[model samples]
Target: MAAVLLTGTGVTWTYVASGGHRFDVADAPDAPVAVVFGAETKTPYLTGRLETTIALVKAGKVRSVLVSGNAAGSSGNETRAMTSYLLTHGVPMAEVVVDPYGVDTYDTCARAVQVYGLRRALLVTQPYHLPRAVSLCRSLGMDADGVNAQCACGGVNLFVNEAREWFATVLALKNAIWHRAPGVASLPH
Candidate 1:
C-alpha cells in the first residue's frame, strides 16, 4: 500500500512537472484564460494570484479570466471579491468567469472543466501551491499550465499552506481516480 501511494505521488509530481515559473509575461504563452485559484479574503497570496491574473489579461498573456474559489455564500465567497477586484482594475465583467463552487483545489480543477467549459488555461497561484494546481487541472484533462504568481507572503500562513499541500497532493491523486464532479459531490453553493 505504501508503495502504491509513493508511485501515485511520483506520477502526480511527474504530471505537474510540465508547468513552471515564468520570470516574466514575455516567457509565457498566450492562453484563452487565466484560472486564478481562490484563497482567503485579502491575503497576500490570494492578492498575488488575482493581481497576476489581472496582469495576464492586461498584458494579453490571456484574453479571459476564471476566478475559481469558494462561492458558498457563507464565509468564502471569494469569486465575487475576485470579480469585483478584476473589474475595478479594468477587466471587463463579461470576460471574467466565476466558479463559486470550488470548495478546494480539487473542486476548482475538476469544476473548471465540468462547469466552466475551459479547454486550456494558465493556472494562477503562488509557487508553493502551483504544482498541485497544475497536476490536478491537467490530470483531469483541462489542457492546463501554471504560472507562479509573485507573492511575498510568509510567516505562519505560508508555512501552513506548504504543509497542507502535502496532504492535498495525495487527495488530488485520489480525486483523479474518483472523477467526482461538484454537481455530484453536492457541496453547498
Candidate 2:
C-alpha cells in the first residue's frame, strides 16, 4: 500500500510539474509557425494569453499565427475576435489565420494537423489546461511546446480543470485510435 501510494504521488507530481505552465518562448529556427487555441470569450486569463502570442508574432518569432476556436455565432468568431484584437495591438492582419470549426482541444489539434499541416507548435492555454493540450498535440505528431495564460481563476478552478483533463485525455486517445476521420491527409487546399 505504501509503495502504491508513493508511486501515485510521484506520478501526480510529474503531471503537476509539467502542467504549471511556462509562457517564455523558447528558441525556434526555421519552423516559426504557431497555432494559438482560444479560451472562454470574456476571461482575462484567456485574453492575456492571446496577447502574449500576438506579441510573439509582433516580435517576429512567429511567422504565422493560426487562431482556432468557436466561430459559430453571428455576433463574432472567437478566433477572429482574437485576431482583430491582435491587429489592434499591432500584429499584422496578414500574420493571422483562422480555424472556425475548432470547438474543443481534440478538434483544434486535429484541425491544426490535418487542415493546416502543422508540424510543430507552441500550445498556449492556462496552466491546468497545458498538459492535455500538449499531450494531444504531440500524439497527433506535432512537436509541441507550451506557453501559459495567466492563472486568474484561482486554485479551485485549477483543480477542477485538471480533473476534467483526465477524461479529455482518454477521449482524445480513443478518438485518435478508433474515431479519426478518413481523408485528413488528402484534403485539398
Candidate 3:
C-alpha cells in the first residue's frame, strides 16, 4: 500500500513537473489556438476557461479558440454551451472551432493533434488541471503551453478535484505512453 501510494504521488509530481510552466493571462505566449477543455456547463470551471480563452483571443495571443467538450446530445451540450458563451462574449464566430467529442483530457489532446492538426496550442483550464492538460497535449506531439483560468471555486468541489488529480495524472502518464488514437472522429467546426 505504501509503495502504491508513493508511486502514485511520484507519478503525479513528475507528470505535472513535465508540463514546464503555467502562465497567467497577461504573460501567456502566442499560440495558434487556445484549447478550452470541457467542464460542466454553467459552472465556474467552464466559465473561467471560456473567459480565459476570450481574453487570449482579445489580446491577440491566439489566432483562434477551439472549444472541446462532450456534446453527447442536444440537452446539456458542453460544446454548444461553450461556443455560445464565446460568441456572446465578443469572440467572433469565424474564429471559434468546436470539437464536440472531446469527452476527456486525453481525447481532447489526441483530437487536437490527430484531427485538428494543431502543432501548438495554449491550454486554458483551472490551476488544478492545467499541468495535466499541458503535459498530455505535449506528449501527443503538440507544443502546448498552459494558462491558468481564474475562478471563484472552493470547498468540497475544489478539494475533490485536487485529490482526483493524483489518480488522473497517473492515467495521463499511461495514455501518454500508449499513444492511442482517440475513439471518435473529428467534429471540428
Best by TM-score: 3
Q: Pick the candidate with the highest lDDT.
A: 3
- Candidates' C-alpha lDDT: 0.78, 0.67, 0.86
**Residue runs of model 1 more than 4 Å from their true location after superposition:** 1-24, 73-75, 183-189
Q: Write the per-residue lDDT of candidate 3 for residues 1-189, one digit (tens) a residue.
A: 975785476456645555556899999999999999999888898999998888899899999999999887433689999999999999889998999889899999999999999998999999888888888888888988999998989999999998887678777777888988787744435
Q: List the residue pairs that clash in candidate 2.
A: none
- The C-alpha RMSD in Å for every predicted model, in order, reads 3.1, 5.9, 2.8
Tens digits of per-residue lDDT, candidate 1, 64-162, equal: 888888766445568888898899889998898878777688888888887778889898988778777887777788887788798879899889988
| Residue range 1-189, candidate 2, lDDT tens digits | 864554455345435534533356544222466677777666665687787686567567678888887776333467767778778888777877888777778788888888889987777777666766766677677777777655467577667777766555555556555647522212123
- Which regions in candidate 3 have their CA more than 4 angstroms from the true location? 6-19, 73-75, 185-189
Off by over 4 Å in 2: 1-23, 26-30, 73-76, 155-159, 182-189
Q: Ten-residue segment with the worst summed lDDT in candidate 1?
A: 14-23
- 10 residues in a row with least lDDT, candidate 2: 180-189
Clashes of each: 2, 0, 0
